[model samples]
Target chain A: MDYSKMCPKFESAAELLGKKWTGLIIRVLMGGPKRFKDIKEQIPDMSDKMLTDRMKELESLGVVKRTVYPEMPVRIEYELTEKGRDLEEVTNSIQAWGEKWM
Target chain B: MDYSKMCPKFESAAELLGKKWTGLIIRVLMGGPKRFKDIKEQIPDMSDKMLTDRMKELESLGVVKRTVYPEMPVRIEYELTEKGRDLEEVTNSIQAWGEKWM
Candidate 1:
């Protein structure tokens, strides 16, 4: 196979998705928008610092949207954008593979 | 959502796939077994050492298999195991997503 002809977009996507803790964070958010604490609670093994970093990265990539709801106490939530929501297939496939193999 | 109920298998799978270059390497091998030089040539940005390390890691995880063929000159090849071939869905999904978004 002429791998040199491989798509650059797929390469970029692979690099982005393959980052440490990024996939898990995205998977957690796939449930719906949640507060910072809530997201942290889901992936117990990940450090708060790591979660924060991944969240920021995802947000910057337009895969996640950070919203601050202002009331008496501001409620900040992280939700997937349309682009991120499109990743459901990717994550779900991983989950399926993991169940069978991992 | 009860984040505590998240599947550990999924988490482990995410971590493994999310490793840098692992996804790309798997995608390359998806074509078929290839020589080390062929694989390296496909992904220009990756260093030789990094590719070696990732290959070893994937082999250890049972995702990749290394075989040596005896001939006039030694022939070595790397190929995906059943487990690795199963990741086509995961990689294809990522490719689809990348085509649409990235």
Candidate 2:
């Protein structure tokens, strides 16, 4: 229990998840894949530019996978990768805590 | 599974925990009550001013309790309230994910 030294892994994880709107974005995706508009609709307060930025960040981190369907009007969708799905525990815990306390 | 509407409780919890250094500070305090110096020492990159600000924020949120023991020289300690301790699940989930992925 003596956490005299900070753990780098935890620090990195915290940094990734601690980004504004990152957790909620992940939470939204937890339900399943969705179009850009769907994701945007869920988080009304987040600007389009911010959502774009966070999505790209998550995509780069391999937490999210963006797929483009080559149709008349290109269909774009976002979904969680396995790694992203792994965060269910983290999100679920947060939800539980939030419901009880926040 | 349809999270069409964002949960206010989850949003509030995410906002609180997403703040920089907040999770790490809580993680450090998870060991037990520690003096300000101890907390700062664990998170070496955080400035004194930042730590002061975060501690005050956490205290005001009722997630942290600050105690002062009157002596020749006053001794102070920071500990998690029951509400704060409840965050163990959240922190632990993050730690587990970090170790596996981050």
Candidate 3:
């Protein structure tokens, strides 16, 4: 991440947000809190392992939160935190730029 | 590349711009055109091979242009195209977010 000697902070952010599938995972979660199944549904091809890894990474970074509820059946959901929501500008810009160019 | 299944354009753009070292390379070039040595000076650890490969990829995608001059020194430089420059917004936003959060 420190490969970018110009700006270590920016490089760190790029490493987190710029990894393949990371941005899209955040984009999907941005829709709202969702169950694991729902997230998997939206990203049909993502392996369970990959999804779990990304979620754990995001969660550890304080960008995403995971909630567990007691019920007849165990329930879990993922949603963006306030800090994560701040990335809206980044996501929107990327989407807009992609739509225009790609 | 289309792992998102949400917006292919955005996914494509992310794949191109979000890869390791790609964003920083563009960030450095945004300052203006520079020779291979200059770019290397800014990003010290990047191997010559990696820099060459990224430059070739960006050049092929029309985001970067490589100019050759028939001078005594055989001058060569890399610069962002209009399309590439448009990414300034993306770079700036990431930098801002990084400085604030990271």
Candidate 4:
């Protein structure tokens, strides 16, 4: 949690982003903000509990922002903040590598 | 294993690299080829079993190559492949992000 003491930056960042569903969650959000169900639609295999947990982690990291709209049927949406958008390059690079290697 | 079937690139790459300690292992190797003990020295908290397992996975993924010397004691070293070097940008990006955020 205390990444400041974690020495190398890549090591801390990787530890934070290298969780099972964390990358996928960020990739899906890269498409822009989405409602909870929409995110679920993209990663169908992820269980509701796992999604919630990943979202919480991302939210805590300031990568994802949660917004609620007061409506007849409460609406909730999750979007990447400015900090999260900085990872666009990282997402793109990993995707390119995966295409060529994996 | 079949990342092609996984759709998005980030999802597959993350699944492959997102496991615990995988990122740290790659970061250590980025300093150039290193013996197993040297790599272990960089990440003192990682268990031998986990390090061995991560090395095996990276080897299988072709990101890392294992070589054994024919000399007396048979020295072993792990080096990143050409394909692995392509990840330099990703590593840099994550490190920058970690420095700025986490």
Candidate 5:
């Protein structure tokens, strides 16, 4: 995402997190660890396809992690990377701002 | 805009600023004041209709202000509102994060 062509920080920020399930997915993963089913349970409205797509995008951005376990059903879990963890502070501020104005 | 249903702050934040021209529009207005033409000049890729729509949306959100001067050659300029001004600090952090990461 070469955002230098654009001056707004929010443009790239939005592009990074603006996808349909991106933010909510991150918020869900913030809990620590979760499986595909667990994430789907957390967001009942999200389609399986969209959730999968978002996970791939976050993983590519180095903001999320995916772990697989050999099991009867082939269990897998998702977690936030260190870079993603830092977003807690920023997102907290965003929450404060949202509650204040909106 | 009612984001209480979502724990992810970025969801709401993205929704508020994630639209096509939303972020770039805010970034451009950060300079101080600009007219419709000035904004278009700043962002050559933006279409007139999109610019008009974005200005209306920002104005309604109380993030951008529109000042119009009645004259043969009408003069109009957009400035950031107090609420919008507060975003400067937040956006700078976003910029830093972007440069650090993607």
Candidate 6:
């Protein structure tokens, strides 16, 4: 989507991260690809519905990838795309900022 | 407060910026000190009550400062404290991260 044209006129850069849960989701993804339960384990407070919704949103946004392995239980895993991996710097910055301000 | 000891166990940094509106408020304050109206102008979607609450939260957190000038109109301005300004780097990182992920 041409997010630049979106109303409220946030910079394309700002609009993406402005959404709720996106940052925290990305932060957890930093630890590496994990199954649905692994991600869920990391964020016990986030309901399964919310986590699924955020994962879909992140995937649609082109920052996260979902992989399903052909197993009896059909294991599913999530990892950052190359583009998503680039977000590490910003995450570090956020962690740093949170340290000082939060 | 000794936020580090708070339950749910967020890093001290994450605890601060993780709050709703705190990040956006800091993002706006990056432009410089702003009056109540000025800040509101920058974020028309935010209600007055919410903005007031966020300012108080940030001030008490020691990341933002409120200055009241005894003028006819009774101007009250808000700015980032030194610790607050340090958040700029983190903000920049968030902006950068948002660019890739969102």
lDDT of 1 at A88: 94
Least well predicted 10-residue stretch by lDDT in candidate 5 chain A: A1-10
Q: Tell me how far the alpha carbon of residue A57 in candidate 4 is from the true structure, in angstroms, after superposition.
A: 1.7
Candidate 2 vs candidate 4, lDDT winner:
2
Winning model by lDDT: 2
Off by over 4 Å in 1: A1-4, B1-4
TM-score of each model, paired residue for residue: 0.94, 0.97, 0.92, 0.90, 0.82, 0.80
Stretches off by above 4 angstroms in model 3 are: A1-5, B1-5
lDDT order, best first, reads 2, 1, 3, 4, 5, 6
Clashes of each: 1, 0, 0, 0, 0, 4
Instruction: Report the lDDT tens digits of candidate 6 across residue range B61-92.
Output: 78889999999978889999998888777667
lDDT of 4 by residue, B15-102 (tens): 8878898877777777888899888887889999999999998898889999999989999999999977777767777787888877
Best-to-worst DockQ order: 2, 1, 3, 4, 5, 6
Worst 10 residues of 3 chain A by lDDT: A1-10
lDDT of each: 0.88, 0.94, 0.85, 0.81, 0.72, 0.70
The predictions' CA RMSDs to the true structure, in order, are: 2.0, 1.1, 3.4, 4.2, 4.0, 5.4
Per-residue lDDT of candidate 2, residues B1-102 (tens digit): 347678999999999999999999999999889999999888999999999999999999999999999986999999999999999999999999999998
For residue A51, what is the lDDT in candidate 2? 96
Tell me the tens digit of each residue's lDDT in model 5 across A2-102.
32246554456656865666767766777778888888876888899988888898898899889999998798888999888766655555556666666
| Range of the 10 consecutive residues with the lowest summed lDDT in candidate 1 chain B | B1-10
Candidate 1 at residue B73, lDDT?
92
Pairs of colliding residues, candidate 6: A16-B102, A98-B13, A99-B13, A102-B16
What level of docking quality does candidate 5 show?
Answer: acceptable
Off by over 4 Å in 6: A1-20, A100-102, B1-12, B18-20, B98-102
User: Residue B84 deviation, candidate 2, in Å?
Assistant: 0.5
